[model samples]
Target: MSVRIGFIGVGGIAQSHLSGLLTLPEAEIVALCDISRQQVEKAVERFNKEAVGKEPAGRKLEAAIYDDYRQMLRREKLEAVFICLPPFVHGEVEEAVIEASLPFLVEKPVALSLSLAGKILDGVLKKELITTVGYQLRCGSFMDKARAALAGKTVAAIVANRFGRTPGVSWYHRQDKSGGQLVEQATHQVDMLRYLVGEVDTVYAAAATRINNKDNPEYDIFDSNCMTMTFACGAVGNFGNGTMAHVGVPPGLNGVHIFGDNVQVTIGGNLRIATPDGVTEEPLDKDMMVRQDSAFLKAVAENDPTLIRSDYLSGVRTLAVTLAGEKSARTGQPVKVADLLAAEAPAAL
Candidate 1:
């Protein structure tokens, strides 16, 4: 049986999810929710244009647009929903999904603040609903190879550097809205580090807003930040992020380099795996997001939690690490992940 999917916050990322879902035969988008009527209409028109040449005569595209997600959820009998809204809006949507006993896939960072992230976690625990987060990089073939290459070996240190154009989203400039680049974009690298290595125990960070003045006046959020993390496994990690790279550089140049006892692995847009025996370069595959979508659909079809690549708990742990780094940056002191999580009680769902 096909799974009916509803999407909340029909924006650029929602469009990407729609594109990914179109590739899965067992998944069908039945409804879309966005605040702007124009955006909803535009999305419908675009989908119609794309479907005209492909779908069979009788298999018409079936989707209704909504301005309020609660109304969409109330009116549509959907098997699953994808929360593609901004970070600040995620907590409430997730709580509603859990209460409705519907499976959901939320985009990264989970929530804009630690308190909301905790709340989402509590709701998930209470509802015991199937959940996944958008950490698509974990589905990359190169990342898997990199993880295997580092397993069982003592990781001495990890270094990640990410540089790119300033985020085009309006919320990118507001810390309360988007959680800045550390939580918004750099969280991917941070999560990868923890996935490849182990749980992060503490973080020390420094940050500055040296550039992107035109786009980010007041500069409440940092344009660049550096963090050092201590993992429970005794390995240390250093990560740097900058939104001020020259315009000539590609949109995103992000990579993780792992130093281990036997092999050193670096994976990003390009892949390089090195060991004592030899060095090999793995070709970058462009199908990571496609594979991620396929995995999520497979999980939904089977109703098996293990099939989901990044579950809700894993996403929360990663969010905690990223948020810890943010706290460290702001306070000029080292922050512990456990303390951060403990300080904020989950929202009452």
Candidate 2:
């Protein structure tokens, strides 16, 4: 039985998901919706090209396009939907999806604030719908190996960093729209930390706009940020992010490194472990997004939400950490994740 899928946003990230969906034999993209008609049409053409010679015999490679996801959802009988909108455009689409009781795969930084994410989560829990967030790093084999290597060892510290240029999207530079660089760009690192290590306890952060100025006046987000976090397992971590990086420079120092008593693990494109004996780098084979999509499809097919690694509630926790860091950066005080979650616990799980 093929899972009829509907896409809420056909942006670049959603296109990545479409590539993954094309690889699944039981997945079919039946509808696509976006605010821009041109983007919708372009996505339809791109998806059609990708779907060529990839569908089951007699299955037409056609998708209904709409300017609004609500309209598409009402018109199309879909088994699952993918919400790939940006940080700010979340609440209403999610509410509609949950109201229909349809399982969905939503992109990261679920919302700009915890309060909005909590309300959507409330609907999700009440409806008991299968949900997965786009924390694709959790679906990789390297993560599996990292977890196995750190099974019994006590982690002492973690170092995570992200250095890159500002994205072309204008909203990403605004604090209110994308929740700053920490919430929008460095969220992958934050979520990966939570997955590999335990939950974060406290977060203190400092940020400043050092490079982006008159030349890049539109860039309102902080150009550099340093966040310090403590894990519940007595592990302390620091993550540094910067958007003023030179474009030609290779992004080498852009991942998490964990230090334990006997073994130190480095997680990025590949997993590297340094032990008393030697260092080993395990090259990754599977696409993380593909694995993530496959897991979500399986969960929906089997009616089990646990099959997906990062669900709505877990994603909300990750959001809580990043949002706390943003708050800390603004207030110059360490923010407790528990306190943040408790303050917005009206719809908490």
Q: Every model's Cα RMSD, please?
A: 2.8, 2.1
Query: What number of clashing residue pairs does each candidate have, in the order they appear?
Result: 1, 0
Leading candidate by TM-score:
2
Give the TM-score comparing model 1 with the true structure, all chains together: 0.93
Candidate 1 C-alpha lDDT tens digits along 17-101 = 7776776677788998999968878877787688776755213446898998889999999999988988877767887888889
Off by over 4 Å in 1: 54-61, 214-218, 248-253, 345-349
Encode model 2's per-residue lDDT on 1-349: one tens digit a residue: 5789999988889988887777677888888888987987876676677556756532344688889777888889999999999899999999899988999999998898888898888899899999999999899888889888888999999999888888887678777788888898799999989988989999999999978765867667888899999999999999999888856436558889999989999986678998899999988656889899988888898897779899999989999999999899999999999898888845553
Q: How far is candidate 1 from the true structure (C-alpha RMSD, Å)?
A: 2.8
lDDT of 1 at 228: 93
Best by lDDT: 2
Model 2 alpha-carbon miss at residue 125, Å: 0.8
